[model samples]
Target: MDAISLCEQYAAEHGMQQKNGNAPWRLFFRKEIFSPWHDAREDPIGTDLIYQQVLHGIKSGEYKCDKEEELASLIAQLYYVEEGPLEVNHLENQIYKYLPIFELKKNKLANEYWTGSIMYQYRRQFGVNPPDVHHVKESVVSFAKCRWPLLFSRLGKPSRNTCTIQTVSGDEYYIKSFNSQKIEYLILAFLNGLKQRSRFVIARKNQCGDDSNDLLDFEVGDLLELINGVCGKELLTETLVRGENTKTCLQGFIQSENVYVLPALIKPNANVMIYADNRNDFNRSQEATAYPQWRFGRDVLDMPLLKKLEGRKEQCNDAMTMFMFIMKYMGDHPSRRNRLSTDITDVIFKPAIAHEILRDELYCQLLRQITMNPSVTSEEKGWELIWLATGLLAPSPYLLKEVVQFLNSHQHPIAFDCLNRLKKLNKGCSRKFPPHFVEIEAIQNRTMQILHRVYFPDETNEAIEVESSTKARDLVCQIAKRLRLRNKDGFSLFVKVREKVLAIPETEYFFDFIRNLSDWAQNINVENSMLQINYQVFFMRKLWIDVKPGDDTNADLIFHYYQYLPALKPISRRTFGEEAENGNLPSHIKNLHMIRKPLTKYFQCEIAK
Candidate 1:
């Protein structure tokens, strides 16, 4: 409502009080002004789109924001809020993400100034919804994927012997030089105070004709080949490098005055990288989305969800399946349309599942359901299905328009109600989808979530769907199915707790590994979240005594050769006699500290103390 109407409405409701016997002010007219803050309201997605459009317009000269006054006015109109308009101190980089990427790349100083300007102008007008670590990780992954498509082409696979990862950003190119670190890993490590580096062959020497067919970067391709040859099927550790005297282990590789590929004379730092002091290193890092941290209010979104969320007789997962129960036409009500507007947090998607819904194009599946199931159904029922998919949770801004347009084209009743309700925030101010989920107390078949876990035998890890009731035997079966192993027998699901490899009982619940891990974390002075796992649920040949590891299957052969062979130690007269056979092995054979003697020697030496 305009201010005059608002004032008049107030005056009519509560009679206006006279001050100093003055005349009634009827001449005062209200002037309406648009506020970006008011429009920003609770919708970050809408605000993000608006800012993106405005920046794009400015870049295209559609918005004449060249002059200081015009730009100032535009900034004020577009971003001014009570926090920014008249404030001295403030935060930055929240709104600059909306700036044109190309324009933002003009200069470092300009980027900083503009980022600050936009920050001062806007400053989260609606709320303080900041991004979390998970959001940051997602952003990093997206940026990396968008930045270098081919570099990640061989992700979760071998780099092999000949390939140099290629990338292009204008004229400056990037090529993965070494397997010392993945690009994303290094960025995350450094950001988290674990400094690590990765070598990338930026450019090639001697111009080539066919760019696609040829190696555009340095001889990092050859280095990858060398590393692969020496490592073989095993993890390349310092022991491997030292043990194999014939292998030319890589210490460092770089190209400057002359290309230097040095052999390992001195041990290299675990997370160190060969630094090439390029002038554009800073810009290149920024381009990779390495430095700047991005934030969002919430990861999951909620808009128009359940028709009868609040109307549920019981607030449990079983209650959630009322729609299915009503499939035989048990409950019928015309008030479903009105009830759909009321949102309650009783219903939610687990975060991983929510990401899957978007990532795996589950939304498309929902649409496909509508088309496939053309059985005689009412418009209200059909709309219910449509509302569950599109309006169930607020989609990303990129998706919202398409969903709206499609529904409008089809003349679906849901289009206007859904769209209008969101922008207006009619029913509730909190339209955000709840991120965490309700852990089912009853664990009903309808509500139970299939917990997926990764089990590793060798270099490759296999995914297995688990549940609270899923036993170790069930997990083994799933692994066998996934790995296509005919001989699943005699193999144990070994939960490696730090230094210990414990075989999980066949009857024990698969989810109990989490409890075991928690216990292990508590045993040490480490936080559960911060504990770096030594190994995961390891699948290997563990139970069969007198059984040859290679005799059972190809997987057993891998476990035998790589895992067992190196760990196998022998006893001899010189190394160890029957007297000392029962004693623990020395920490190192060359150790001269405390003597690990026979049981008799311990009693003899203790009297001297």
Candidate 2:
């Protein structure tokens, strides 16, 4: 007998004949690359050989490939070049000559519809569209695209195709749509109580079904239908019709039967079961317990409801069962809950729960839960409850006074968080106690001290001359100080002045124009203040910074003379005021505001007389 015949005999003995391991199957090819002709003597029939040959050819530049096209050519040529179509036919004849496996184990010969990994790989290589769950039907069998359903089902065989669950109420839902690996990943990350349910289903290395295009949206109307089915214990033996006009029983169709499966998005109540078979197989509820003995943990033991039970020494199985039911529901059906706010407030924030859980224990658990839940935003109501509760437990202020005092200190990061919240809470509201708010005042004083130290920490006398760097430093300090007092009357006054100028049609640029000039003034050297004005005039004139009536424009010279002059002073405030015994002081002491020329006519007009 030929090698093909011998190989077929071996395959038959090894039980390599089946569609989903049912129909007889045979591996075929258009050609084959002989091992003897290549440097590496590897079995060409094996998947590894096929992969290695394609990869090696591409990497070695033999294929001259770009993306999908090149890969496809290489795969087809590598697998078929040697045997050729005629030789492959001859080999098939020889193989079947000795191999008489049952057709049930030889599904490849049944129809072209039965595709395997080899065909899939070729399609991918050739830029052919890969099949998705949507392409699958009752007659078509395939592996699942989602991992979650697989894990939850835990059957040893691969899934046939995506499942469309039909609710008794005539609603339809499609689970495991295309590229359902993400759904599996999420389920795995947060495995709850359905571990046992996994044993009853098929387990495949592939995901359970496609999730990419799967859409899940339903309403109460759909859920009621499902609940009625479960409550009535209807053993659906026919394909259930769903959507606008589906009407069949759940178990009527056999495996591999040609039909569409529909699933409902609406969550049935706990009393309802989702039927995978005659008895409705319900999904483990999200509200069900995620872990065994879950109530014993810090998350629950410290919860207010638990604390209330603890106070009464009430040890009943009913409470535990109820808690587990809720936990499971939350895990399995997150969308069903109206809101988690009530749950957090009543179950988590109760005073008794607080008393039971140690600060560290509570914090670590909250942190872990939040970190794992990608959807939990800081501003989310649930998250806020968690944040405040956690703060009170671990980072809780040591004393009521510490609440405001620590915020004033800014000695730690927590102080920043506190200040942010405090600012928001007291935004436009007037303070009931000003002088007593020593913490707020202390924080302000601390900021000012830092600025003073940065500018002229050691200068006791006011005769110190201002330097460019010192003036710049003071400007930043002053700006920061103003920002801190954003809630104060001074800031209000600044806003009013700005608004007044902006309100005018032509003078709208007056306040903003001065603010821009202030930036340049800060950069100039004190000794060259007058020269800076000259440059300013030349620059503005070049840019055509002209003002027309109703244009809200101001004279550059005037704005600079008023805004920049007052700002350009000795680093020391006293340099502008103090005088020597001879009545001589800083040369730059004269304010530029004294200049008489319109700001618009700096270089064009005569100097102030």
Question: What TM-score quantifies how close candidate 1 is to the native fold?
Answer: 0.22
Candidate 1 off by > 4 Å: 1-457, 519-535, 546-551, 567-609
RMSD of 1: 35.3
lDDT of 1 at 538: 78
Q: Tens digits of per-residue lDDT for model 2 on 505-581?
A: 22122212333343355355566432312111001111123323222223233222334333434433565455544
Give the per-residue lDDT digits (tens) of candidate 1, residues 1-609: 376677666765676735543224565222112221132334555444444444455455444433443343344333442123433333244334334444557787765576555554334422255434233223323333343344323343335323223222224433444542454444333332211111211221222223444222333212222232332112111111211111233333222211212222223332222332222231223433342212101112221122333443343233323222223221222223222111111222222123432311333323323331213233244344334333224444565565556565443445555455344332322222321111122121233334554655456665565543356887888777777665677777887666766788887555445455544555575444433345567788664444432234555434433354333244235465553676644534455222322312332233233
**In angstroms, how far off is 592's CA in candidate 2?**
20
Top model by lDDT, which number? Answer: 1
Angstrom error at residue 82, model 1: 57
Clashes of 2: 86
Lowest lDDT 10-residue stretch of candidate 2: 534-543
Error of 1 at 211 (Å): 70
